[model samples]
Target chain A: MFRLEVRSSTPTWFNFALPLLAIGATLILCSGLIALAGAGVLEAYGVMFTASLGDSYAITETMVRATPMIFTGLAVAVAFRAKFWNIGAEGQLLAGAVASCFVGAIPMPGPLAMVLMAVAGAAAGAAVALVPATLRVKFKVDDVVSSLLLNSVIYYALMALIEGPWKDSFSGYPISPPIEDSANFPVLLEGTRLHLGVVAALIAAPLIWFLIVRTTLGFRIRVTGENPEAARYGGIHVERVLISTALLSGALAGLAGVSEVGGVHFQVMSDISPGYGYSGIVVAMLARLNPLGVVPAAIFLAAVMTGAEAMSRATGVPAFLSDVIQGTALLAMLVALLFTAYRIRRVGVAR
Target chain B: MSAVFEQIFQVGFLAAIIRIATPLAFATLGEMFSERAGVLNLGIEGIMLLSAMTGFTAASLSGSLWLGVLAAVLTGMLMGALHALFTVVLGLSQHVCGIGVTLFSSGLAYFLYRLIFGQQSVPPNIKGFQTLPIPILSDIPVLGPAVFNQFALVYMAILAIPVAAFVLYRTPWGLSVRMVGENPRAADSAGVSVIATRFQAVILGGALMGLAGAFLSMAQFNAFTFGVVSGRGWVAIALVVFGRWDPWRSAGAALLFAFVDALQLRMQASGLGHIPYEAFLMLPFIFTIVAMAVMSRNAVAPSALLKPFRREER
Candidate 1:
């Protein structure tokens, strides 16, 4: 019988390779599931890959799909670094989308209005986050529960707006009226859905990395996240750090919402996010909370989502296959990551 | 004033509240157990959705509600075990692992549901459990039908509250669980297996969560959709805080939410188009946050909650 013992240190190469191993394991497990779903496993994989990244058109759409994810991923990565646990990014994103809808509907100079949309979206996101952050800091309320609960409230509020005040009477649907043309993100690619939001997402990674790596605020946040008690003793205002982190996290998530509306959807509705906020958590974890790593992680997840649709269309499998794969990847990566810090070695016989 | 009283005092409305609260009661009790044993299973939403799907599908195929219930319970247990694998065995972060479980369960449920039942113009339904009315109690005025008459699972759920309380407070096993949650190192020194106790607590809690899902599919709605569970699981987390981890209080909290929910449904049915229905929908969730904020200060969670136990270190 093999008994497991923990090692103090693991090989550095294995640290980087673990994510690949987790992905490979997830793919293998999902292939079995696909086979059970009655599709040829290799063929399904083929469709998923080709549809997401094979051609320039496909790759462009994948980037479009990745844009919001990049924003939300960075948003979550920021919060998790400080151990803030802002699960309400979903709610924050919705709030931003609502604010953007209002600002985008305004008749103003195109560039000015677009800038205002981003600003308003960020402000609203931060405002929505304020409730949970304040409660967590002042009252010691469980941020996770509070943040999670807010998602439902924010969701219904959006529903009320779309179904009541913002309803597009001309469209015969519950969606909001289309935003003014001035608010639309300038197209980046000739015929594809690619827009300036991709550029925004690209700019976000380096900016966030700079903030985390080069700034005084970043140093304080890192100190607070690692050991609040020690930080307090070190004269760092831990609560202030927490509150600031929460606000910034919400702002990033809010940007994801603005981009979705201005760049991708153009009109606000309830289903504006296909779990981008939740997927952000996955992306953050996959990148190990490194702001710069969120870029590739977001794109990888976006490709999986894009490919799931194509795989479903081609092989008659459900599009939800991506959810399973994503979820499995998250769990597998977590388990695999353990080996990076502590390797399991065989010990004495099992008790 | 008379009309307002009449609107609030209907026996049928009260019965709806009872029916709605039953599943929440089950989930709250389940979560309470896990929290007491020092784990936060955020996978409640995903577990409910997956179990609901499994329960609905099994019932539709074999035409046996009991088997469907069993299947759902089994699924919940598996999820609980999966959570334990991450949080207990591997000593990973509870929050991430719980969320991961939820994602996996929701995804798998959706995929399986789609594969087993192709896209239909209208979703298929199941033959749900019939309501059971107790002998003389169900015949009495307003209180009779509301309290004494319900689906079989509702009775079990209500009964489980007292039983759970008894098991937790009176049994030696319960003592060990509480001890482990409060101080795992101490529990280990006292000869209790922290790993085993945590596993039991999580698995038991998960079974109840599964039962809650089964109740929703096999009794409450008779149909499983993506939105069937919604955020009821999250609401259960709130109830745990509102109840302060006490079984009886938790049941009361669950009923309170259900009353608000049922009232909203009734208000919508009354054709009061003047009022925004979304406001009514938002009421329960808003009430949860307010209640939690007000109650959380006094609420005492298990000291070891969210902290993975390592005997060798401390």
Candidate 2:
């Protein structure tokens, strides 16, 4: 039998190398599926990698896709850093979208209206997040279950809004009416759908890093996540820090919702988010829960999704193949990371 | 008072509640077993999805409901083994790996379903499990049919409560599971194999989750949709917490939630467009969160719920 022995310390270079290795392994694994699906492996890979980054327009589209992921990924990373599993980012993003939609539908000056939409979106997301956070802190409820359950509830609620009160008048479909021109995000590039939301994500990355690394709140949050009892003993208000982190996390996720509405969709729809909130969890994990690392991680995932779309159109392969890659990549990464901390050795007796 | 009682207890009201609660009961019991053994398998959701599709596909092809059910259970066990490999052997984080399992399984199921079924205008259906009424017992007034006449899976779901309770408390394996969950180091010192026990518990629990999913597609609906198992798996997770990780209490909570869920549906039907159906849909989840809030205050999770145990760590 082989037994795994824990390493005293993993080398620094190895820590960075594992992600690249995992990506390679994921590609090889996915290639097998592609072959089974009767798609040309090289052609599919070519479309996935180059199509998304092949041209200026494609890059902007990729950024548009990455925008929400950046916020949601940062949201997950922030909460995870403090050991809070904010799995309800999906719900929070919906709430943000709901608020942004309601605010944007009102006729007003475009600039002021857009500002209000973002604020409302963030506030609404934070408020929804606090529900589970408060329950966990005050009533000892498991945040994981509550937050996850809330996602379903929020999705249904969004559906109710679109299907009933806010149903699109012209199409008679389950979609909210289009936002006022004033509320629409300004296109960042002349010919691309890239919007102000991308800028927000770019700004948020460093701001989140500073919050986690430099602020007193960051110290308390890190301590609480590492050891709540020790944080309490060391004069940190662990509950308060956790609650605040939850709020910040929700707010970031909410910003993702606002970005989607103001930047891309321009209206709340039934299928507003294609599991972006859940995908954020993967992004955070891939980035190893580092706030700054989440930026590149979100971009990478966004590229995969964008490429999957191009691949599907190009090869007739189902777009969900991207989900397969994302999910499997996480498992592969986990095993690769495991080897970094431990090594397999022959045990009992050399047979 | 008679009229009020009659209105609240319509002809098929009790039956509807039981039918709705069956899947949840199975899932809740399954989750409880895993949690009791110190592994919280969030893969319950994805397992349900995988089994739903597999059971539906197998039943439709073979025209045998039993075979479909078996296929679902096997698929669930396979996913469970994967989960066990991560949490029990690799000692990875429970929630992360569980979520990963869910994503992988659900994605795989969806991909396969789409690949095989493609985009059909009308989704295919199969001959589902027929109701098996207990003789004499099923004929006893309103109580008789509601309680005794149900799918075989429903009867098994109910039986699972006591059987699970017995195995967890009465059997030697039960003691080992409890010991491992509460304190793995101590359990290891006492000659219990923590990894083996956890693996068995997770796989067993996963099979039940498969049953729950099969119950939806192969027994209740007779057809499968992407939304067939929607939110029920998460409800099971909440029920386990609300039930305080006890099989009996978990069953009771599942029944109660189902009752409320049935009532909400009835109310929606009666209200006839006055109340948003979504509000009614939200009832079970909202109630679950509230129940967890109240129940969690007094109920503690298993001591080693998410902790990975290593014999040499101490």
Candidate 3:
């Protein structure tokens, strides 16, 4: 019989190979569902791949989709590095969208409006995140439940806005009015939806990576997460680090909403996000909490999301196969992480 | 405000509170059992959604409501086992794994549902549970109709509180669950199986959550809409904290939240105020957060709640 034994160290290739292996395993595992759906697995996956990454237009669409996840993935990666459980990224994202939308609606110079939107969105997100951090630090509240509950509170608030005052009075649709035309994020490519936010998201990843790898705050965050008591002993302000981490993380998530509002929809709505905040957790885990890894992870999920609809139409397989793949990828990645800590040893035959 | 109060004092209002609380109570109790065993099942939201779908499908297809409930409970047990396999057996991070379970289950539910039912303009629904009033209890005036006249699943939830209390506080297995949750190493030294007890507790918890799902789809909504379990599972999680993980208290928390919820519905129905309906929907969540802030100082979570037990670790 084989059993897991703690490993002293792992090889460097494990990092690169593990995620690929997990993704490969996830695809293979989900193939069973495709077969059950009475469709040829290969044909379905082909449809999915071609539909998501095939042409320039499709590629642009996927990039647009990946933008928010990139931001959120960074948010989660940052917070988790400090061992701060922040599940309210969804709420923060909404807060950002609302703030940015409010800013965008005010008639102003295009460049100025854009700048103000990002700042306001990020600030709003940081403010919402502050509540949980402050609660955890001062009131001894568990951040997990409090942060999670905030998502619903924010959601209802958003619904109230759109359904009430923000309602499109003419059509009676519960949608916020479009932002000033000048405030719309300029599309990067002609005839494609690729916006400035995509570029910003791409650049933000490496910048975040740098900050995490090369900064004093990053070191403190890492140390704090690894051992709070040790961090305290080492003269790191543990509680301060937590609050700082929360602000940074929340700001990143807020930018996700800002980009979506500024670059894509240009207005807020009830279904503004299709659970991108939760997807950030999946992306962060698959990245092993590495900010640089978040880009590819976000792209992978984006492709699945973009492709699922096409796959549904082509092979008649349910598009939710993408969702299942996301969950499986996360679980598989978590399992693969086991390799970093332990190895299987066969004790019976060794002697 | 007086009109709203008038709406609240009636037998109908009490009955509404029971209807709303039934599902929340089951879910809260389910989560409480899992947490008591030191496994926080963040998979709850997705589990309830999946269970609702499966239960509705079974009942609609077989023309048997009880069969739907059985299907839901089994679904919960299976998913719970899956969760246990990851967190308990592999000793993975409970937080991320729970989220994964939720995402996975919710995805599977949606995929299978679409494959089986196909997309239609109107969602398919089934004939749901009918309330069976308790004989002597129903004869009593206001409390009777509100508390006694409920579906079988609702009755089960009410009975489940005391039963859960007995099992948790009095039984040997219950002690083992508590032991594992609070101090696994000591329990292991005492020869109690931490792994097994935790698995059983989580599984039992999943079964109860399944009943909650069954209540939603088969009784309350009478259909498996995507929004059928909308945030109730999360609300239940909050209620567990509010109730301090005690069965009776958790059930009481459920009732209290239900009271707030029923009041919101009543106010909206009365159309007496200019307040947006969404404002009312936000109350339960805000209430929970505020309550947590107030009660957090005195409330203590199980020490081993998020910790994974590995005998080899120092």
Candidate 4:
């Protein structure tokens, strides 16, 4: 029999190795589904790899897909660090998209339009996040349930907008009117769809990392999450830190929406997010809630997402395999995290 | 009565409200039970979806509704155990594990359904349960037919409230569940097996959630669309909080949500073409959040909810 013994300190190697282990385990586990679907596991994975990372075009596409997730990953990482549990990132993302789209639609100068869009989107996201934070602080309402429930409300609100007021007149489709042509994000590469928001996402990660690791507020956030009582004892206003964390988190998630509107789809729609907000949770987990780690984690998920579609086209496995992988990776990462805290040791008796 | 109000309280509207509430009642009760035992099964959304798929597949393939329901309940119980394996035995974070379970289960549901049915223009459908109207009670025009003339599962859900309340408050097992949820250490000291009781409660909760799934696929929708259980499980989560985890109040909360839903459906069907139906769809969720704020003054979650018990830690 083996027993778990607590480690004095987790080795730094575990931080990187654990995510890889989780990904490896996730693939090996999901391979059974491929086999069950009557497809060759290697062949499906091969297609996914080549299609998502095969060429410059594919890499660029993956990066395009990864941009929003990077933002969301930062959002969740910051919030979780402060123990705020802002599960309404999906709603926040939608609110940001709507706000950004509202700004993007107005006839204005291109660069100025983008700036205002980001500001409105971030403010909208922050406002949505503050609800659960305030509720948790003032009313003692459970943040988890409130945050989760708000996703539905925000979703319906988006649906109402597109299907009613924002209805596309020409197509007769239940989608919002497209944003202004000038407001479209500047394409970074000549041919590829990669946009300026992608570059911004790349830069935003390190900036967030600095805020979380090097700033005074970051120390307060870390302390509050680790031990609220101690943080209060140490003169940190715990509630204030939580509210601030919510603002930062919501702003980052809102930026995910901004990128989607400006970079990918330049209009608010029913499926603007494709569950990217939830995927952020997976990315944050894989990153071990470290803002700096979010970039690679987001890229990995983006690759899976881009690859899964190609895998489905080539291999006949459902495209949902990527969704399963995301879920499995999260669970696997959680299980792997246990090893950081405890080591298995042989015991003489089972007990 | 105004034109909208006139449509909202029609006999058919009453029946629609009951039909809508049935799944929610079951789901709310299921989540309530699990939370009462100190386990927050955030996997309710995915659990309901997976169960709906399995139950629908079983009924369609076997041509037996009861068999399909049984399969769904069993699937739910298995998933519940899986959740317990992580949260209770392994002592993982309940919130994360629940999210993981939901993602995993929902993904599996979609994968399996597509594989088995082979994506076609129209999804496969099964001839679902018929209204098992009571001979005498269903004869009553206004209330009787709406309440009594329902699917067998609907009747089960209606009865579940009192039965659940009885089991939670009357039975010794109920005492154990409450004890474990409130103070695991005290319960352990009192010779109650906290882990086992929690496991049992979660499993039982899963069974009820399975019934909710079964009702959706086998009775309400009669087809297993991907969106069949969309956000209903989340609604159930809110209902549990709003219901204050009491059986009667939870069931009432389900009914209230159903009334709002039924009203929306009626308004949609009433040629109110200009109104966005989604606005009405948003009502119950908004209502739940506000209700939680109002109820938080008095309502308290399980004391030990989200806390893992390691007997040796203390």
Tens-digit per-residue lDDT, B8-66, candidate 2: 67979999999999999999999998999899999899999999999999998888999
lDDT tens per residue, model 4, A208-233: 89998999999999999999999999
Q: Per-residue lDDT tens digits of candidate 1, residues A208-321? A: 989988998888878888899999999999999999998899999999999999998888988999899999998888887888878888888999999999999999989999
Q: Which stretches of candidate 3 lie over 4 Å from their true place?
A: A346-351
- Model 4 alpha-carbon drift over 4 Å, by segment: A348-351, B271-273
* TM-score of chain B for predicted candidate 3: 0.98
List candidate 1 stretches off by more than 4 Å: A1-15, A345-351, B271-273
lDDT agreement with native, every candidate: 0.90, 0.89, 0.92, 0.92
TM-score of each: 0.97, 0.96, 0.98, 0.97
User: Higher-lDDT candidate among 2 and 4?
Assistant: 4
Alpha carbon lDDT at B115, candidate 4: 86
Compute the lDDT of residue B213 as modeled in candidate 1: 96
What's the TM for model 4? 0.97
Candidate 2 chain A: worst 10 consecutive residues by lDDT? Answer: A12-21
Model 4: per-residue lDDT, tens digit, B1-314?
A: 38767876777888999999999999999999999999999999999999999999999999999999999999999999989888988889898899899999999999899889988998889999999999999888788988989999988998899999999999999999999999999999999999999999999999999999999999999999989998899889888888988999999999999988887777777857577788778877888788889888688889999999989888
Which pairs, if any, clash in model 2?
A110-A182
Complex DockQ, candidate 3: 0.83
- Candidate 2, residue A218: the lDDT equals 85
Identify the leading candidate in terms of DockQ.
1
